[model samples]
Target: MPLDAESEAIGTLLLDRGILSPDQLLTAEDHARDWGVSLVKVLLSRRWITSDQLYEQLSYHYDLPLVDLMEHRPDDTLIRKYDPRMMNDRMTVPIKESDGVLTVATARPGPETLLYVRKTYGPRVHMVIASHFDLSWSLQRAFREQHSHEAVFALAEIDPEMSAQQVITPPQILVLYLLLSIFLLGIAFAPVPTLIVLNVLLTVFYTGNFLFKAVLVWVGGAAQESSSRAIAAEAGLLRDEDLPTYTVLVPMFREPEVLPILTQALRNLDYPLAKLDIKIVLEEGDHETIEAARSLNLEGVFEIIRVPASHPQTKPKACNFALRYSQGDFLVIFDAEDKPEPDQLKKVVAAFNQSPDNTACIQCRLNYYNARENWLTRMFTLDYSLWFDLMLPGLERLKVPIPLGGTSNHFRMDVLRELNAWDPFNVTEDADLGIRLTQKGYRVGVIDSTTFEEANVSIPNWIRQRSRWIKGYMQTFLVHSRRPIHLWRSIGPAGVFGFVFFIGGTFLSGLLNPVFWAVFAIWMIFGEDIISPYFPLPVLYLSMLNLLAGNALLIYLTMVAPFRRRWTYLAPWGVTVIGYWVLMTIASYKALSQLVFNPFYWEKTQHGLSKHTANEVAEASADVEEAKG
Candidate 1:
């Protein structure tokens, strides 16, 4: 397609003024053509000149006065009159109205924008050039409250059943009451048989849990091997010009010190910088991190989205707020401490291409970079290796709903929007969204790529993070299980069983481990005579088998987890995972207490505590300085 007269004029003006060299101009033009973007965007994305210089040249070319939106803020009333989404999409905003004429601010002063402004905001509007950052910040300031409200309440209002706002519903409560009543009455009437039945049920549950996990490991081990290789080949073959724009959301809260590590990691991604739409999503109250972002003076492709201070100050809510401003065909969330493999995004793109049209998400594997740091870190790494590398693939192989990892899960923007994104009320919003996607007729695929994250070195910090995750799991199980028939119809019997063992059983096991251990200890200490009435021979034998075999199976699974990555040194640490489970039991209790008292509370996990991450942060900061110099 030929450029419009105004676009050609702007390009020519840049050359005449020596703002862009001839070779740079030619390269940018080719990129602009290939990327389906304007010459201004191509130049800006390349960082050939500062935004001020480009906007100033734009002001000169268009014979329009350049305005600083921050100094002369836009009118809230006038901005509210127009659709915010439309305004953001077009990168234009109505600044002020005076004497029947509206003064509008726009980053792009072109023919199309001129026509749109005239057609939408009346012909008497005056146009002014503003830098993209300034315009975006102004919009954020003007609509902060509205967007915040929407981010927190949109899912609840749009799909109440999927939201965790209500936590336990009326019907679920009634069912729980009925179960409790039955248990109490049975204990009151027939003690021995009731205890026997209870013992049998728990033993069966324990057996099924271990069996399900073993099955997952077996199936997941081989799942997608050929497909993953094919996807990697396709990813290698993908052309840069043909690559689509990808939005990366990095939501941070009070972790300014580690910002450089994340930024450096993102910069290392093997993708075209011009096509990366990276947003640093931060809370309005996090002044330190916000200031740190400004000090970096990142490229034009990186935008800092200042999320308004809102209740449920969660990463999901911040992501939801930033989602409104994101313009991409695909979107992904990365934590502040994440360092994904360079080809991870490309692999995700390829996976999506080969997947069914119903596929809405492609989850990548996750593990820790500081696996050898300590026992806790090693255990955490092994756990992640099992969950992401093994169990997730199993879920995919069986066509079950795969609960997403906290980060590195990519999504199709259209389906994400249609589903109202993540539920703000669910602390483990990623996991909940995965199940919700399956229920909504969308498939979630798992790829073989990995994202390395900082492992928790401190036990207290680990507990806080784990507790939040367990609480979120509880919320997901309760929310999905509310409509048993609906869930069954949506995900099928296989999925229901997976959900029970995977989601419900995760927290339940944590709570049940100590109880079983206590029972075993009592039997050993007091002998069989004290509790022989309650524990019959068959039930007692089954319980012992479940106790012994279940732990051994889990230990074997953990030992094998690190074999894929050839991190065999960490395999010996798997035997000591019993200590890790004890910590999980503590977290589970905390999670239960929080779920009962304060369900929506987000337990903030402090990062940059590990020695490895601290060293990386220092190195990253030095690299930033070198780049600047």
Candidate 2:
């Protein structure tokens, strides 16, 4: 839709006054078209014209008074009559009243706000424009003190990970001791027998793990029914206004570079502006990122929530802090570097619409924007493709617990809260939440939509990121396995089997990869003749099958990961993941050391490390908008 006559006149007046030049106006108009937002939004976002300047022009053009609410306080009685939430949520403040007529100051004087004022405060309403900044400042000043608790999420008090850890009962501790004692006894008294037993057990574990994933790969490849497949067809059926209120929480750290593109991607979302409740969560201490967020001069739909400095400064903690203040029917999380496909939200709504009532969470696919940045990224892409594109769907299809990736997972607000939100102590809160959801009889699903993020392209950066993940996986395993029988009863046999295979298998792959590789090296040097006597015939056969078929099947899965994305050239080189596994093994050992000493330590992944910048992600977002246009 073109701008209304009044908005056009304001633009023309701004041009005439040289507040913003004609070239700026024309360029903003072009950008407005691309972003599917208003031209006023474009100009304001670019800082071509200040909010005060634009609103001043609007008030003059429309003959409405421009008021700054901070300068004029509302009647205490009148302010108490209406809900504080409504005023804050709508960016409106009741300024003055005469003869039962109320004058309201608002940043947005659109039909929605006007209708709300008229219906709630009676038809005698006078609407005046105000600078969005001043309106926000006034709202905070008037309401923040009374309800500061409502603004920040109380995560520090509820560290679910540690709480669960402290509750480990006597019986659970006894079980751990008994198992350890049994292993020690076997090793001390019967060394050769223990070696044979351990070798056979490990071989079976590897085999089952291999077969389980092989099934997922085959099933996923055969189905090829990704969540992205239906977005185009479903977009026509669902109007933007028909969608319920949606809140997207973006938890950013010191990522100054990606902020502009982040806002651009958000503005490009295919949702109604009034219903979009997007909160950019920033740490109060990070001046660089806070300034970056402030520079965007975002719309009323986007709010900057400053999180107080606290221990366990992690993303989940930040998100948990923002969770309560979010008033959305459905909510999702996005990273600072994420450039989600424009229709991703629509896809989540549709998926929720079609799913069973027990289906509470839907995880979207996450891929790297810098896939071709270097060798590290290419392997990261292949790894992600296998996990998100293939294995996750298969897990969901099999009615097993789906370990969620951090970004792009959507949830029902009530269900999320009922589960007590993310565990602030858990590093991989996404994965841990999936397990918790399934334990509570809620089903988690996989969607075909994707959010492209910046991949860690440097080896040290990759190791830091990978080690944190490994440490968390270890935490989750120990936390949940505190009561094994209860876990078995909750998820049933398949769930228990899957938990052991998936989580246990992942940790083992990193920790045991080097050990297995060393053994293989020794075996290769000495030949089977020297190694044959120590191994029984059955152990020898199982080991040989795992060495040949099991390892090969896994390598095959990585190779075909690119084929899932139709990146055929990359698929041919996926064989290089063998070396990638070595890196993971190294990180796994590091994670093991951390888990023993500093379990809650989160090695933050540095963003914007790739040669590619956020502009590439923004260009990709624009391309989607262009295709839709």
Candidate 3:
């Protein structure tokens, strides 16, 4: 096997066919002369051609020298003996009867194939020749024909909206109207107690919520950092050879502009091509994204699963459809705008192997890739960093249910399937599913893997996205809290407290912050005597302490987030985030209104307006090429 003349001749053929560049051929020859390595290895190490490309080119170049199944035609006697259907459907190679043995010629020889052959021929078989390429092709062709339905089902739609008539009511609007009417009527009366009651309620609600948030952050932040370090350590131990199969499901709809970046990011993952199951889930009606997918002509490993036309167009619905065809034991979801760490999947696998069997989900840290895109993105990234890199891990350590981010959630296939997948009807199905998982006695852990996603930097865009998220959280709250006993039983006392502090507290704070700020402003503008009699000394002291502590905690949380990310320069923006919270309050009100009106309407967030430099693009491209190869 000392560089067979035929193989050398095939290398020359590859050069002539432009499969290997002139420089690659020269490098291959240089490596052979200098290091005594095979030209194939040299070429591979130099990143000239992929193994699959080399195999394909070599097999086709030396067509006759390579195994040729056409030359050894099946005998007419054997053909007559076996049914035509069996010959067509079953993968078999004919062998001539020999002295107490039958010598067969097969295209591929692997453990699975050998098992089948042994089962069929009673273990009295001898192999004359084995060609891996031919066997792979035959197997792929057979599988393509027989199980293409997997692909079809992966693209099918599963949403069906039921039309039910009920009395329509505008609760948020009605509440606001009632408040306005009371205020107007109070003007005719003293109007002093009304203002006092309102101030007291706002102060109590915001202060309580803020204190709860601060406590959760303090507890969760340490655990999240520790979990991240653990994940990174585990990732370091994984060899390229031991990398497990990973399925990346990116569900898209009318997002043609981001497809290029999305696919490119997936292509950059530090995983084997054979082990990567990158499925771009698209809607049947989303012709724009479909066309974008087709134009990429991405490698055979990249597949476009077209989710058939469905009633309620939702991301989880598309994911549910694709879940059926996923062959990977570990599944990770990435949003259209996400750029996940190359070894994130490996980290997930390592974490899963180390964790208990009940740990069914691993949530990866998420940050904005375009952190400096604008003031909005910067603040959004800070908030997200604190939530994922701090709050989530703390909840996990506390054994409380963790509300999942929109993407970068790695799930165990068995548990995911058992849960009947994501609820198509729930807008924030991921958040809902997190609660459901805890109820079913499954725990979710956090991994250190970070997924950089596109933050909504524009004010209007941010509002729309934030509003939808708040609305979904509201829906999740209602769905779970409809039965208080069930919630207490499933989550236990600690979890119930955690949920109220984190989810309910966040919502209440968002809704009440403006009111508190207004009271402070009014009191500052008016004389102290106007407010002093109504607001007692104890009440005033408590409110002031709460406000001071809450503001300090907000600043601390925001500043600490950047430190965790190793981007300390971003800490200055903690002052700006206060204004951002005011904006969130506005969005929360809009979201609350929409919850009763348009619960299922998806608020579209636009992207690709960030000022990414050429260097960033080149670096991203290089990452993509490495991942894809």
Candidate 4:
């Protein structure tokens, strides 16, 4: 039975019986054009019609013959008499016995086999298990266990207008006002060397900060290098069976175009589908995507979780809703445009199982699939590769709280649930969660997993995404630092130093780098004589050394990251990353401004509209074809 013939026959039978409307028949024909499955299978999978409803419709409308599978039983003795070899040779054959019925599992059971079973076995055959490469995986588990009700209610309760209130006065303006007030007071009171002492103290504080950063980076790098070797050695001996269930949550929004691609990628994962619980978390209002998902008719292993419309329409909120329904022992998150390496989950699983107790989370390496899409993407990818693959692992090895990447983070379910999932209020939920985990005495480790995500290929899009991230980092900084003494006591000195160097370093560096760049530029433009004579050689030398050391660490970080990725060709992008940070500085300022005015307003970065490599376009097109078919 050819697919076209089977579909046509089914359609004709349904039409004659008045079971299907003329419009529905036409729709079925259109659906069958690309999909290599029967109309019945497609309809059933799509939830447009159910098995019981179809039978009822056929009986009433067409006077067609229908047999209930539940009432049937195959010849048990005959099934048991057949050898395994003989059973394997046939397209459809009875394999085993249970009670008085035979169990018939098939490789490619055509309608003829179904008809033969009905006629020969008197429609009483107990079970018909058709095994094919593209069977419609049942969504029974999704409906039974998924948190759709909670997600729906959550969406309704979500306040989209929720934003950060501007309480912190602009530091620049405040500093200037303080300085002016001090100058005015100085003219009147003129005796104390307050300004001189203040300047000296500021100089010392900055110098110490710079030195501390340099030392931490060195220590972090050494720790990471050693850890990598240990992981590699351990990886060699680990087996797949030892690993536990790994849940991958993919939160989607207006992502109809990318769903098929994501689906295909997940299907290609090396992990066992039965053990892998992949949750496709979608927003309630996204009907287009929901419909698109139904059409895919993916395996039973894939579940669609609808996130109710909630205020603070952030990714974390959606994740939190999905977390309620997740069934895996360990959970991981992937963004809409991610194409992680198939073995990435396995690596995390292996790492977690080997060191089960201490490790609460494993942050995988994230790079961009479309790095060469444009200058912005290329720079973005390089920066990420450096951060995740180099800096984070190093930070973790040194027993520091690693600021997690937005995606590809695997966590122990109980630990994650204990933390109440990601902060609904925090925009950069991943980073905030990482800090929170550290506070809870849980350790986050790094694995050899590589997840390739879409970089923001355009400047404006890049800015929006980066701004949100920076703003979130600022929020995390404030939330944790509110109890400074307690934070110090909790994480200890080294951990506190790591937080300052990594988390605080990001904020401070972005804020101050532009000032440093301006000074350097002014010096370059004017003659050496025109420069401030008061600025001594020691100050200049220290500043220069600080800049040099930062650059060297960056280079080493970049080199180490791509080496881990086996993408050594991209190592040269370290030089270009400095220019990228200039963009980050710009974004930081924008984020600071928006943080107070519109904290919850998500800076939307549009995707799937890139004019990158031909290969990407072709692949995307193929995905569309597969989805439609």
Q: What is the C-alpha RMSD of each candidate to the true structure, in Å?
A: 2.1, 5.7, 9.2, 13.0
Model 1 lDDT at residue 592:
98
The lDDT ranking, best first, is 1, 2, 3, 4
Task: Judging by lDDT, tell me the better candidate of 1 and 4.
Answer: 1
lDDT of each: 0.91, 0.76, 0.69, 0.65
lDDT of 4: 0.65
Query: What value of lDDT does candidate 1 attain over all alpha carbons?
Result: 0.91
Q: Which numbered prediction scores highest in lDDT against the true structure?
A: 1
- Tens-place lDDT per residue, model 4, 1-629, is 23477567768877887767898787766654534445654454333454456545534333333333334433444544443223322334553455766555443345676676566445555534433211111111223223333333332244211212222335534765999888778756862345444434444545656555445445555555655556656655555445566678998888787776687778677665545667888877899988988777665446677766656687887887767656678998988778888877766766776674867898888888887767777677767766765567667767777788889898999888666667666678889878878877888888766888777767888888888888888777766665567789878788888787667767667777776777678878995665455345665566666567756666566545566557677777666777787888988888888777887676667777665434554675576566545
Give the higher-TM-score candidate: 2 or 4.
2
Who is ahead in TM-score, 2 or 3?
A: 2
**Candidate 4 runs further than 4 Å off:** 1-243, 524-537, 547-568, 612-629
| TM-score of candidate 4 to 2 decimals | 0.68
Q: Backbone collision count in every prediction?
A: 0, 3, 3, 18
TM-score of model number 3: 0.72
Give the per-residue lDDT of model 2 (tens digit) for 282-313: 87789998887775556556777776666567
Model 1 TM: 0.95
By the TM-score metric, which is better: model 1 or model 2?
1
